[model samples]
Target: MRLLLLPLLFSLFCGSLTAAESVRLTNGEWPPYLGEQLPHKGVASRIVAEAFALQGVEVTWEFHPWARSLQLAERGKRDGSAVWLHSSEREEKFFISDPVVESGYYLFHRKGYSFDWQQIGDLQGRRLVGTRGYDYGAAFQQAEASGQLRVNRVTSDETAFRQLIAGRVDLFPMDKVVGFDMLHQHFSAAERAQLSFHPKPLRSDSLHLLLSREVPGNAELIARFNQGLAQLRESGKVTQYLLEIQQPLSLAP
Candidate 1:
């Protein structure tokens, strides 16, 4: 009886240990998506947290610079990154979750600038503002590579917009919602009035949570996260979370 009881107690302890397992993810200060000050750490962070909660796992986030965030995840310093764009290079080292949100890229120019483009070819000879370390898309990247488009690279989106307002660049491309968030935060009403997003969006892509393959148990973690995300979508929680930020679920499409 003592032997049997000892085995049962050990099993219970192991089960509790499993139940208390948690994951730590690195995140960058991307507002309206993921931020330290925003409610529940912003929409995307809330979604990721709740989804993992549903899987009986807890998650904690540490803020870092975007490049460092990816590096930490990739090197197994953290279990994963809270969110990032899926790329072939990233895919090589990480297990990417189902997309948490879709992002659209649009060209923003100063109002009255009369700039418009229907295709990449139309961008020839144009001065495009690009953020350092950001990937716009294959077409835009290829165009920049071939010298079809000249880009003035800046360190951040805010800097890019400042350059645009200063007439330093012809146009800039950014996520519509993210660009608006920046406008709300940094630009005066007068400055806001001077800017507009082009009617033609450059492209759209989905953002995903990337679990580093180098991290132990990451495969199971990714599977659990994906399952929870699907459940959140079905239950309309994802939509509810977006509405809290006054952003429409439709924006993600």
Candidate 2:
């Protein structure tokens, strides 16, 4: 009986080693994506938590300012940060997991203001409202660099949208789903109805979970996360999770 018990205990210990205890990830108040007050802390949060659970791991989240969250994760104070866009600079600093959310940039303008642009060049002379710490893609960045466009950098999406409605900016660029969520939640029906999203998207991007390279076993952790994410996708939990967010539009990739 003792010998049999010893083998069982050893197997359990090995299993524990394979299944890490938990991961602490930092995030910010990205509503409908990640927010403390949101149901299950929002869709991306739900997906990440479920994915890790599939691998017998638990996730703990801490909310901070977006910049600080990234700072903490980059310094290895946290295991990782979630729902960040892919950039070459960031790719060097952290190991990004499989795509967790699909996102794209759209030009949001007042309903009374109709404009058409075939390329970034066509945005010349436009007064734009943009959020701080956002990458609006290379084309927009280059155009901004060359003085082709004017942008008023604000602290939050809410501020940007307000500026747009007040005629402070000709166009505001942001993630379509996120921006619309903000508009729907914060503005009146009339105010929301006054907004229009350009038919042509400015850019398409996906958000991913970023693991700190400085952390030990980071590679293995990402591998486990990817496997779990794939499993979630296969089981259709991923789709259901998105649906639970109550997004106004389908998020199909």
Candidate 3:
């Protein structure tokens, strides 16, 4: 009887351990993707969460600075992160899930500015501002390296927007969806009246979930997430959820 009881206890302990070792997600503030206001309400966040949930896996979310969160994911200190733009550089360090969102980079400026640049060379003498640690794709990187584009890095998107408004910077590059969201949330009606977003997209990329190399069974987790997302899309639940959380201002034409 004693030996039988020990085996039962050990089996229970292993089951608990397996449950605890399931999916755990790390993320940071990235509006319309993952952020504080809506908590885990962002499109990418919900998709990833629901995907894992469908697999009978429980997920826990922890927020940190974006860079720090990525570091956590990279080191396997956390299981994964949502809403990361897929990149080769990142691919080298992490396994990326199927695209959960698509966003385009755009040029934002004060309403009165009349800047037009079809190519990097067109901005040879102009100063551009962008969020710290953000990649504007290869063109901008080459321009920066050749000293053709003067770049200013700010700590946050808000700061870049503010500097543009204050005429402290010539141009700022940001994700069109996120930029519009921020503009609606942070700018007063009067302030918004003085700003404009260009129709031209600098670059478009799909956002994905990034898993650390050390997270055991990440391939299985990613496959499950993809399956879940496909189901959500087929059922129209993804669109419905996005509509439910979508801000009125974000729907503006």
Give the Cα lDDT of each candidate. Answer: 0.87, 0.87, 0.79
Instruction: Quote the lDDT for 208 in model 1.
Output: 95
Q: What is the lDDT of candidate 1?
A: 0.87
Q: Per-residue lDDT for 1-253 in model 1, tens only?
A: 9998999999999998877968999898877898988888878989999999999889888998888998999999899997888889988999999999878899988778877688899989888889997888899999999988899888899999999888888889998878888887887777777787787889988899999999889999899999999999999999887666655312111
After superposing candidate 2 on the true structure, give the runs of residues whose Cα lies further than 4 Å from its correct spot: 1-20, 246-253
- Every model's TM-score: 0.87, 0.86, 0.84
TM-score, prediction 2: 0.86
In candidate 2, position 16 carries an lDDT of 82
Candidate 3 error regions (>4 Å): 1-21, 37-41, 243-247, 250-253
Q: Name the lDDT value of residue 93 in candidate 1.
A: 98
**Pairs with steric clashes in candidate 2:** none
CA lDDT, candidate 3, residue 146: 88
Per-residue error (Å), model 1, residue 203: 2.0
